[model samples]
Target: MLGLIKKDLLIIKNNIKFAIIFIVVFVCFTEQSSELLYFVPIFLSTMLFISTFSYDDYNKWDAYACTLPQGKKSVVKAKYLASLLLTLMAVLITLILGFIIGAINKNFDAKEMLEIISGVVVAIVLLQSIMFPLMYKYGVEKGRIGIFLGVFGMSGLIGFLFKYLNIKIPNNVIQTFNDYWFIILPIIVILMILVSYNISKKIYLKKEF
Candidate 1:
């Protein structure tokens, strides 16, 4: 399983320009505050997860993977795991770069770091809830619409809620994320992903290989 994941990561490492832009934007913005930095991981994860399906289509590797002893379910699980791993690495890079930029300017703080981490976590959960099922149901070509809609619709709602609605949400979501339910939150995310994986595997399992 780990070998399969490494193989998948190596494939993605081949085209990292998209990942590069996220870092570039992080530096260009100059704020390097957690609020601004949080979005980097969120955005990177979704784009790359969607690509999980796209790459499979582009390379026509599904047939090849299906022939492996671990079977189709493991192939699908490997993709999800690879996405999570890459997403974590991306988040780490963003944090390290953000920290450097912040230190250079002497502007970084702990609460801000919490906010960034919370924002990324929330974004990952929301994205997986929307995209994973769509990818399972529609595959990449048809499912990109769902991704666009999920991405844009959330963007608009956030704009309206914060910009126009003026329904101010306290920073507690970030400030005290680990204070009470932090452990449960990740467990829930893992369970959700597992559930999604089971469903996706069941769906793809029946498809002609």
Candidate 2:
């Protein structure tokens, strides 16, 4: 499993230069307080991790991996672990960059930074949790299209509903979320990842290659 994880990390390391350039560009251009400061790097990093599936498919890694003990299971485990590690690294990098940007802007709000980080991290994790199973089942290229359509459709639906239906959240519910989110969100993310991992493992176990 460690070797499998290393393989994915090495693949990502080769592309780290481009990821850094993206991070720098987003951080420099966006406001210090903008949520993009926290989101762009993490999204880019996770997408890089997802690209490993493309490499694996092209190289026929899965067929070769099946010869090893627990190979299929390890492959899925390694991917989720590697992705989590990448997500963590992105969050830390953004935290450092956020502080620097705040310093330069002469206004740093720790609570606001925490809020943005928390929201962005949860959103990315949820997105990945939804994506991994699809990537495993459909392969990377199709999975990318699925994600695009899913996000686009959901966004459109949400906008239409909000504009036409005038749906609004109660302030108390929003406040509750804001207050307990730091505690509740992690628990929800953990559950989602666990479920996503289980589904991906099942798919890979039954997969042809």
Candidate 3:
């Protein structure tokens, strides 16, 4: 597990240019700080999925990956680990940047920041619940579409609902995040990821090589 995670993190680190661009864009933009936080999970999960999947498929390394000593289970486990790690990292960075931007602007507050963080986390879990199974069952080729649709469509619906309801404080809808999510959400997400990793490992192990 450690070796697999290190391998994936190293590859992501090598793309310093992409990371720099993301950090720059995210840090410099001050207009929608909350929105930025809300989007970090989306950005991290989707980008990681696309880059990792495309690299393996394009290089025709699925077979090679399956042959590694770690086997298909390790490959799937590594990818899932990478996704979760990157998602959390993105959330942390987004929060730090959001906090700094808020301090500079004097418009953002503690409650708002917490709300932003909560919204992003909820979005990540919701997206992952749908995307992982698709990716686990179908691999990346057929799975990317589900990833795209699930994230974008849900985001669009959330936006529409906010607009339709004329919500001034978008954070209000998720106000109880601290109480419910902070306590219950992590347990749920961890359980989901563990279940996903085991199921994906089984599926990968059974796949025709």
Candidate 4:
């Protein structure tokens, strides 16, 4: 498991320049928008995690790795674990960046920061819940398309519902979530990730190669 994780890390290390560029662009553009800035770390982490799939596909690593002792289940678990690790790292980085920005601007809101972090965590988990199964079932190229369509389709549907149906989320509901998110959200995210991992593992087990 550790070796598998190390392999993914080496892949990321090989592509560190792209990660650096992404962080630079995110920091520059999002400095003024705290809400959007909150998403930067998780977004980068998720993107980096997905890029590892592309690397494995390009290098034909998956087929070769399955021949080794760790096997497909370990591979799937490694990816999921790597995603969790990267997300945590990203969250930490965002916290530090938030502190620096708040210190500079002298406009810190702990409640808002907590809300943003919670939102990012939920978003990343939801994305992975959709993405990993597709990637395992269809491989990276098709999975990337699935991810694009899934995200935009969901966003468009939500927008349409909001615009035409006038479906509004109540403030109290948001407040309830914000109040109990530290307790509720982590449990929800963990359950969702576990389900996603099981689905991915099943898909990977059935995959020939």
Candidate 5:
């Protein structure tokens, strides 16, 4: 399992230049934007990590991986683990970049940063929970389309809430969730990931490749 995880990491490492460019672009946007978009990097990392499935498919890695000792389950597990690692890295990077930007602009807010972090963690977990199983069932190309549609749908919903309904979410609600998140979020995320893993594993197990 560790070796499988390492393999995915190596693949990402080979694409370090692109990742660096992405980070720079995201950092620049976050630094300039007023909205709490600090979570974007984490979400982007999750997407990029997930896109690795397409790369594996392109290279025929999936068919080859089936003959390996670890089998499809390990392959699926490694992708999930790799995503988790990338999310953690994104969190750390966001923290550092947020602090630097705050220090420069004299607008540091620890509570807001924490809220963003917690929100990003839950969002990525939930998004990936839905996405991984779909990818396993439908293949990466369709999975990528699904992800884009999901994002667009989410964005539209938020827009409708804010624009048409003139409804703004209360900060207190966010605060309350963040207060209990240490206990609540972990349980929810873990259960979701476990369910997603089972689904993906079942799909991969029955796949011809």
Candidate 6:
């Protein structure tokens, strides 16, 4: 499992230079948007990690991996663990960059920056939790398309419901969420990943190749 985790992490490490360049360019072009600084790293890390699935499929890694003891379980568990590590590294990079940018701009608000980073991390984790199971059940190519359409369809449905149903969130509720999101979001994300991991593991183990 450790070897498997290292293999995926090495893949990300090799490709991260390009991600860094793109992030730097984005920062230079949109210096005003600190939120983007926090978001792009985590988003890119997620993409980079997802790309490993394509690589695995292309190399036929799964079929070979299943020959090893606990192979399917190792692959799935390593993937989730590697993703968490990459996310933490991305967040750390973003945190450092946020501080540097804040210092340069002379408008540094530690609390605000932390909040934005936390929110972005939570959102990305939620996305990954949804997508991972689909990717495990279907291969990466189909999974990507499914995720796109699913997100679009879900967004449209929510918007339609909001517009037609006149559903309004109370200010008090919003404030309550704002007050407790730091505590609540982590719990939700943890539960999501655990469920997602189990689903993905089951799917992978049942899969023939």
> Judged by TM-score, which candidate is best?
6
TM-score of each: 0.78, 0.91, 0.75, 0.88, 0.81, 0.95
Instruction: State which candidate, 4 or 6, has the greater lDDT.
Output: 6
lDDT of 6: 0.89
**Number of clashes in model 4?**
0
CA shift of 99, model 5, Å: 2.0
For all candidates, the clash counts are 0, 0, 0, 0, 0, 0
Q: Which stretches in model 3 have alpha-carbon errors above 4 Å? A: 31-34, 149-178
Please give the distance, in angstroms, between residue 43's alpha carbon in candidate 2 and its true position after superposition.
1.6
Better of 3 and 4 by lDDT: 4
lDDT of 5 by residue, 1-209 (tens): 89888877787778768867877776676666523657667877776787678789899898888788976668888888888888888889788878888888888888888877877789888989989998888888898789789878988999988999999779998898767888888899899999998889888889887
lDDT of each: 0.73, 0.86, 0.69, 0.86, 0.82, 0.89
Q: Which digits, one per residue and each the tens of the lDDT, describe model 3 over residues 1-209?
A: 67777766776777656666766776666455455655654576457655766676677676877777866667777778777787778777777777777777777677767766766676666566566667757877678787787778878988997799776765755687545777767777778777767776777777775
Off by over 4 Å in 2: 28-35
Best by lDDT: 6
Candidate 6: which stretches are off by over 4 Å? none
Off by over 4 Å in 1: 31-34, 149-181
lDDT of 1 by residue, 1-209 (tens): 77779877876677667677766776677564456665775577567666767787788777888887886768777877887887777677767866777678787775777666756775686677667767767877777788888799989998888898798767886667657566767777788788877877777788765
RMSD of each: 4.2, 1.9, 4.8, 2.3, 3.7, 1.3
lDDT of 6 by residue, 1-209 (tens): 99899989999888889998999899999877687677889999999999999999999999988888878779999999999999999999998999899889888888988888888888888789889999988889999998999888988999998899998889999998899988988898899899999999888889997
Model 4 alpha-carbon drift over 4 Å, by segment: 25-32, 161-175
Model 4 weakest 10-residue run by lDDT:
27-36
lDDT by residue (tens digit), candidate 4, 55-121: 8888889999998897676999998888888889889988888888887878888779978898888
Worst 10 residues of 6 by lDDT: 30-39
Pairs in clash, predicted candidate 4: none
